[model samples]
Target: MTNMLVYFLGFLLLVFGRCRTSLGQYSSDQCSWKGSGLTHEGHTRDVEQVYLRCSQGSLEWLYPTGAIIVNLRPNTFSPAASRLSVCVKPAPESSGTNVYLDLNGWLRPLLREHEQAAGLVRCFGILEGALFIEAIPRADISRRVTAFQYELVSDELTGDRPSPAEACHLCNEDQLLLAVCTKDFVARGTVTSVREDTKENRTSINVDIHRLYRQKTQVFVPGGPRARRWSGSITMPRECALKVSDDDILFTGTLRFGEARMGCATRYGDFLRWYRRAQRLGTNPCHLDTD
Candidate 1:
């Protein structure tokens, strides 16, 4: 009788333990399943494709993985619409491994209004991996098709080139104006020298200032060292690195790391003209709806 009682108690404990384990597994699986659905037009569907319901948000894998191939298709109301802009970055908690996704080359076709439908589809080959995607709608025009579709392919991609940080720094006119307004210094300068120190893994550029539209008083002097020439460093991966030649006029913002940084504004031919107009008006032209 004693032996029977002990056996019965052991059997009950084993059953209880299995039940608890099963419940935990079920909960985890449910969460993963829930994240797989696509939310669209006030309805959610459990679809294989990942869907972005809003303009700005992050997209993550339903199940954690090391690498993935993403097929993205963005739908706009019209071919001329320019509302969707997407950027991908590694999640804050992700490993130090580089996350590579080509945005400029991939997004160009989609952004062009007259491109063929086939050319607009973007396929990300393979990445060390990314945890989230950030999407923003640049145009004020109402977006009829707000949700975009994406599918994940579970293939490990090796030997693919990693994209430089500069490639992901694409910003529209409004964003550029916002940076200019908020930055401590905005200047038009000519590149005097570009030095890439391979040993130190640093890239520095020396600029000869032509004019200063803005500057902090403490750092500004009527005839100080910065009045003539200023030096700043840029951080970019060795691959797809930036090259600047002497006599290149750059519209730069000095908010990044307290150093002047050049971006898309430098590439525009009429940026300086527009910037001067904004200065005279004492307003951000990008902020005005007329722009």
Candidate 2:
């Protein structure tokens, strides 16, 4: 596998060397880019460049041919740009292409054509440079599309992604306070279900939210038993072992690749006690509606 990857990298380098000087097309907007590969049929070595300057967006390449370098950047310039991470989730039907992170001339493979079919989300730092999408040569390109959604995630509150051992790290008081203020979603809920996704190596945590203090992008929708309250599922590392809790738990997490990911969470009762203490000391990072 290593030898094959190295050889492929060398091949891409040779192709990119010739295509680098060629003029490329840019997306119409900062959000999404859609293009067809038929244009590159006669010029098989043509490399198109696409720049998506948005926090989130999608890319679709119908009948993908040649190659495309997708440059993803945030719309706004802020200190958070340094902390920004990029995540891409391929469309389940995405095929006929291999994705790689191109840092200068170096190439790091992100997804193979078969792996993209699984539609798992992959993330990397913004400094990783643009995505190099190379189309596999085929005699017939029928119904094939290389499509994926991208999101720029700021790790302001999420110190590290909840992966493997990082997910098991308990948040300190300071981090906990920041999570409440900065996380994408916050709610008080009961753990209704816990399912393990062995393939993804992550666990799904369904929460029956009683009080959704705040949420971005309607992650929690009105559901569960008479449509009384909001409910949603959050993903976390299986190693975290977030079991079903009878007590109302304060759930705080972020949305990545359009999925909620678990962050700092504790029993609502425990949070209430800690919050009251911090309030008394006037050391709370931000204010929240306790009522």
Candidate 3:
């Protein structure tokens, strides 16, 4: 009876060991699906599966296990390089590690092949495994620059992933108001001419200033030098290939780095309304400079 009892105990131990081994394997499989600490082609691979989703006016790449999504807006600009920009944020429950998306290998080709269908396939780069899509005009593509420019905007997961409704809100009234309040320079100008400087590899937009509501240091007087016609090239990323046409009224902002940025004011009247609201908010948005 003692020998039988000892055998039973041994059997229970074996069963427990098997159970632990099975659980270990299961845990490994789960982690492998999340791409934990895996490397591929010299890039720290964190995505288990990558796939694209398309809707009427949006294209998105979803990584189920990675808990990340990249959504590209439809290209509305007539020029190839003028594309709708995409904003990426981390999804809830994502690992705090930086994620990497390789654009050159699979994404670039895919965009090029379906350029027409995709609309704006200018350029893309990974920022902490999040993707920022910039429009690269056709002219810039001829330069044969193999490397794409990417800006790492943030490190921490701010909040929940932006829903489709939220993603579609680009340069809305609230955004314009925020830009006017926060940005150093804000103005309305007409694009007199657009030229590309091959030597500098930059696009210059010659604008006839219409109105100035904000500047960093100098104040704008009607018909003053600050409000006069200005022609200059912005020191923006080459991937931000902005295309302006003659007589296009652009709402412009200047970054602290002295880079001029413009976005399409689709609702021009609404933008003006918001701009007025921003002006009343405080004196922060009133300094004007033509740097």
Clashing pairs in 3: 81-136, 81-137, 99-129, 100-129, 122-136, 214-287, 215-287, 215-288
> What does candidate 3's lDDT look like per residue over 124-143, in tens digits?
32221333222232322222
Tens digits of per-residue lDDT for model 1, 1-291: 999999999999876544221111121322121222112221211112232333233333332222222323233333322323333322323221122243532421222212211113233332222222212222221221112223322121112222455444566655677756665556655555567757434455555555556664323334424546544443332442355654445354432223333443454345656656776887664442223
| Stretch of 10 with least lDDT, candidate 3 | 21-30
Clashes of each: 0, 0, 8
Lowest summed lDDT across 10 adjacent residues in model 1 is found at: 21-30
Total backbone collisions, model 3: 8
Structural similarity to truth (TM-score) of each candidate: 0.32, 0.87, 0.31
Angstrom error at residue 22, model 1: 44
Most TM-score-accurate candidate: 2
Task: Identify the leading candidate in terms of lDDT.
Answer: 2
Q: Output the TM-score of candidate 1.
A: 0.32
- Model 2 residue 222 lDDT? 96
Higher-ranked by lDDT: 2 or 3: 2
Candidate 3: list runs displaced more than 4 Å: 1-169, 197-202, 217-231, 235-250, 263-267, 273-291
